[model samples]
Target: MSRFPTTPDLDRLFRPRSVAIAGASTNVDSPGHDYVQAIKNMGFAGPIYPLNRSADEVAGLKAYAALTDAPGEVDLVISCLPAGAVLDLVDQCGKKGVRFLHLFTGRFSETGDDEAADLERQIAASAAAKGVRILGPNGMGLYHPGGGLSFRPDLPVAAGTVAFLSQSGNNAVEVITRGNARGMKFGKVANYGNGLDVTPGEMLRYLADDTETTVIGAYVEGVPDGRGFYEGLAAAAAKKPVIIHKAGRTQAGARSAASHTAALAGTAELWSTVLKQAGAHEARNQEQLLDLMLGADMLPSSGGRNIAIVGGGGGRSVQSADAAEENGFTVVPLPDDVRRRVREKAPGLADWVGNPVDQSILAGSGLSSNGLLELMLESAAYDLAIANVGEDWFFGRPDASDRLKHACNRLAQICETSAKPVAVVLGATETNNREHRAIVDEVRDDFAARGIPVYPSVERAAFALGRLAGG
Candidate 1:
């Protein structure tokens, strides 16, 4: 038999028709309360049985004393009980024929207590014997909006095709919240803390075959099984774009991860090699991970490294050139045909402007940056393009809001009609000017609503585009 050959049925787990929350409470502050409230808030289309020993009701639903008491077939049981109470919970789950048991309870092996570690081992053994798949002993569990599931009540309700797996619950929340702002609508998400029974490997294998998941992103502290993880990762990456952000690189970081999830961290170099060999992209940090996933999910595939950048000022052009070249992209010079087209509209810029298309020099020219972007993408000289919004420049002009909105609308139209991918660069809302910040935010929201990928900097846009282009 293969070691880790069998993967869990994640479809049933992710899309459970009936769910029960053990240790459900009425206290509005606790995780127990959060789970119950979150499910109710998500408009779960199934029966929600809250298993509470004392409370008669939890978050407006009648509470059962135990999982066995829940009057119907329960597909998934979320345990918010203490670690000491988990062994009994597992037995109850088995007796009830529960398909999945997600333990939001912590203080297990990650606490570095011998008794706790032993208890965790026993829980895993019992769960396996009962044929009930475990999601976490100290994790936040699932957040699939499409299936009416969420770990938190405040999360966005939009359903998408992007799937993400993380070891830390907070990290998972950050990625979902932040990625959503970047126009990344997430489909399935799991934060399997400690990764006791259903490891990242198993999740990857499941997601590899998942029809709903178009792109996969992972935030890993460590893996319980290395070879299995690699195989699963390789399988998934071969099918769709997979971006892995492996944390716990340094010794201190590893030690922290060990405490955080009882995970045994590996060397950064080794992890990098493994990720590359598995045909997956490696992200150094959370920011890079989000950027890569966003690019892979939002932009169409591009096999060429030739980049056409149009927007920003002369300084931005220089920085963009440096960023593009540094990231292994060729900032190709403007083709003669493109230059002649520019000369017809603006004779002065045809000679002065090079590849980056300095918007400053074309101030008086009837052509806008969006116009230049359309023209550049038309030529065979470029494979992909980047258009910089340069909101700071707009802030200095008359009627910044109207002008910015007009430019962005044109850019959005261009992106919609263009055959090649165009990544837009809009500065972060870092300005002290309130009006400027609001205008920038509105523009970003507009772009996001139109499904245009916007990066905070030209360098990030370049990096994401370059990596996606296989540079």
Candidate 2:
């Protein structure tokens, strides 16, 4: 019934027994240095060799003059050398029987240099002859925390259910960092730039059946093989929900994508149709991409498009309704039974409260927002629920700490057994006030630890939920 019953095994390429860093340097500021730092810091066992002719030691690893001189079999090679030097290095990699070569070096076809294009072709030819897998000629390589792998030292080392493949290295870093703030953990990520050999489609096919991956997110600026990617997307969607951000929609944007990754960005309208057909959610930007990544895995598959909004004032409620409806969700009013339950339980606010249950009305009314949240969960009238933190109002009060803690803890507890996808809306990341930021961060951490998905705003939460709701 499904296209891909099994996916490719990329273990040796990722979980190498021995890894060599080509062009590895002791320069703390360089990408070469970051690679070595990440490897050693992650406690990656086995032989770790740094191949650099000029350096005596690179990030504390014993420096080898070259790959040929390195002791033992080199399973993986991460090249951080200049693009001009990669062709010669590719031949050396083949000679040394290296199974994989990950290139952090750029200046290839993306540069639009004729000489650079020829060098990229040579890399492909050399790798093919030796049966060596090339990750990228201009890429950030791999980021798998469980395997003690990463291109940058700052990324999260704790792995989780989400796995992502990004064509742009910077976008990869942004997605990982931003997703981390929202309590997102990742299983694997790859910044496969200028994809000379290891195409985005292949990574998709691999992740489609990856046991560690339950949810998948992808950011692509371009791809050479449209049919291959579509097939991969369809197959992956059959096994798990796949969310994608297809960049380079505009003519100017396509030119930019080409220059950045040497990608052939297809038409936007066509991409929209293709993604919908493939059962993939098309993320307009990287932020929404993170939302899909978290919601797709954390929320259940049966989440309906009908959303019941609670919390926020008149303006926020209107905004939430608009956001939900705009994203293809129905923001329904409080059903008759739920209203009845609220009336009996807390009769004072029955007349004032409605959909988007304005928290301001319930003050000193003996009714709690948590109680309303629970009532929504119990009622069959609502398919999904949104709980707004109303952080700005809470923090403005002198008794901010007690009020914030009580509300967050209560909502966190209620969401523990929620059958429906109950989303909590909190304020955005605070930068100016350290004290306020810490308080919000603590609340977010609590919700994350308890396995509840939290969003910065109702709009974002609604958009994320809408995508998961099959919009």
Candidate 3:
């Protein structure tokens, strides 16, 4: 038999045949008990064994006193016990022949003390010796739509292409909550806190082969084995886009990370070199990270770095230009031919029809003309095109009801012919009219269906373009 089974190992951990909650509780408020109820509520098909020495039944399921008492082969064991008790539980799991373990306890190696570090090492050795894989010691654990394993009560976990892994539990929850609000869904999320046995390298290697995951994102504090991390990232990045937000670079950030995950904070330059060599895109902040991942997840691959910026306002165009330059992309000026075409097509437009290709004149005329947009796209001067359509274009003109649809269709045709990526930025105030917001939503959906990403801000759109161009 293969040491690592040819069959996918995650099925047992994520969609187990039988699950045993080692620290099962009757209180609905407890994390341990709430998760058990979440599994049942989300319609897990497998039998659930809630293990508690004091209880006979838990959350309507038959309770067992220990792993050994649970009937048949228990594929997954979710231990919500204290850190001190985790070792004994592992011993029990080994004897019981449990294959996968999900630990939710903190204050282990992440504490950065000798005792905690030794305890973590021992647990790793024990699990490896028993041929059992561990998820986390200080992790929030795993989430699978099919298995309904979510510690977060607010967000409804759903299966999608994106799979995320993070070292910070709060960051994991924040990403899930925020992404859900923005219409971004996930297939799986693992908060690999402290990373006792399983490192980001191992997780990336595993996720690379997972058919359920298409786009991978990570919030990494530090990598223990730089070579292994780089190798694993290279392999995974070759298969799919890997967006990483590496924290703990600064001295203060490093100190913060020790408290967060007991991670050894390294120099920022070293981290940047490793990430660049590994073909991974490093994000500067949380918002940029999300935008980069969403863009990579949603947009098709492209070959060129040339970009065209279109906007109804000159100010938005300038903002796009600044962002593009800041993110390592060259903002090319429109060629003479392209400029002449734009001027002829929209005579009402401004005379400064260069790289930005402003359509303010046409938009201001209340004509709803996408002529300038089409002219720039057809010029083939750019590998990607970004259009910033203000709320005025959508709600200002009485005859501009179909302006968004017309622009979207034109952009789609341009993308098809050029085989280049296209994105849009629809800027509207949070307190904008419902009708104007509806137009922005419609445009976003339409562009998404065509495999183009839409952003609410020009900076975000430019950042996404930069990532793709960098890759």
Each model's backbone clash number: 0, 0, 1
Over the stretch 200-246, how does candidate 2's per-residue lDDT look in tens digits?
77778888878888989999998877777887888888899899999
Model 2 RMSD, rounded to 1 decimal: 2.4
Per-residue CA lDDT of model 1 for 250-310, tens digit only, reads: 9999999999999999999999999999999999999999999999998987668888998
> Number of the top candidate by lDDT?
1
User: How much is 104 displaced in model 1, in angstroms?
Assistant: 0.5
- Superposing all C-alpha atoms, what RMSD in Å does each candidate have to the true structure? 1.2, 2.4, 3.9
Q: Whole-model lDDT, candidate 3?
A: 0.75
Q: Is candidate 2 or candidate 3 better by TM-score?
A: 2
Q: Each prediction's TM-score against the native? A: 0.98, 0.94, 0.86
Candidate 2 regions with alpha-carbon error over 4 angstroms: 1-6, 54-56, 429-437
* Residue range with the least summed lDDT across 10 consecutive positions in model 3: 1-10
Candidate 3, residue 207: Cα displacement in angstroms equals: 2.1
Stronger candidate by lDDT (1 vs 2): 1
lDDT of 1: 0.91
For model 2, which pairs clash? none
Which candidate would rank higher by TM-score, 1 or 3?
1
lDDT (0 to 1) per candidate: 0.91, 0.84, 0.75
Candidate 3 lDDT for residue 223:
70
